[model samples]
Target: MAPPGDSDSSGKKSVVVTALDGVINVNALFTIAIFVGLSLASPGQRSLNSKESCQPGILTVKQLVIFEVLSFSFFLFSSLVAQAIKLSLNLLSSEELAHGFSVVVNEKILKAGMLMTAISSVMGCLFLMISMLNVIEIKTGMLFCGAKSTIISVTFLIVLVVSGLLVYISAAWYAFTHARVHFHRQRTGL
Candidate 1:
């Protein structure tokens, strides 16, 4: 009998590698966006004191800076974690290096790391959204008092909802596809 991952014909390794690569890519992209966000927020925040902030439900420059910084920090942490996971995966997945080193990535640790990265990425996105809202408020006007501001805010919300649904559907499709294949194999006693 073959041990786990001994079956060279299986697609699990490729899928995992692909996922790892995707995570790394996403972290890098988020990091770049975080830097851009900081640049945008910092100037506005520095120019205005708390007393001068626009009133009545509008976000301040300080708030935008805070959210952007939080997003930046989360993305930075996620990038570091993803890099570590990538390094471990490279070592473990390689035939020559797999035995040369005493280090082994525990499955639980790997799962935890993945979960951490996923959560961090999501949090970073949430923070970015808040920052964007603040940005639009500042860039447009205060009090949601203008037609441009109203339209921009409403359109942004609509786009966010649509994109979220798209992501959910895509993830569900992938998950159910895998489950369906597993069910077929079990039913056939493979």
Candidate 2:
């Protein structure tokens, strides 16, 4: 059995691992959404080009493909790293393997993997957002103005997406700041 301090540390590490596992699941859903977006855009793009690659709307389709592919790549990479971290943690947690792995090494690996996965997940969302805008543009019209209705609808969607992103960022900022402050106070016995 671990001492009190070690128990606390292990508990915190377990919490982090659980959080990362949840993130991997969420990212998987986003990965599926990426494919869905591609399928939605594919019909229109195929009708437009299908051959003459130099077509006008084809370029937009290409850009959409680029963004979607990027989103998929980033999310996939994050998932891969999360899996690797889980594997490493599991291996190190075993009594036989635990002797060879230092706590510091495990901590460093967890922190690095968590940081990379977080960054990649955020980037993937950004790319997915951009691809979504492209989908809106493709379905609605060219140069963002097929009609007044299309313009208004796209505007509304953009506002919602941007607002959602702001909310997410704000929440993350608040959560991290409060958590750190609480930890500091606890450590200082304040």
Angstrom error of the Cα, residue 113, model 2: value is 2.1
List the global CA lDDT of all models: 0.60, 0.67
Question: Model 2 over residues 1-190: C-alpha lDDT tens digits?
Answer: 4334545555655765687698799999998888988886554453222233322376678888899999999999999998888776556555564443444434445566766887788889889888887776666555333456446767787788678777866765564445421000012111
Across 1-190, the per-residue lDDT of candidate 1 in tens digits comes to 3334344412544555577678678767867776675565544332221334443232376787789889888877777787787776665556554343433346566667766776777777778777766665555545335445545675776598459746945774565444321100111112
Which pairs, if any, clash in model 1? none
Model 2: how far residue 172 lies from native, Å = 5.2
Itemize residue pairs with steric clashes in candidate 2: none
Each prediction's RMSD to truth: 7.3, 6.8
lDDT of 1 at 74: 84
Measured on C-alpha atoms, candidate 2 has an lDDT of 0.67
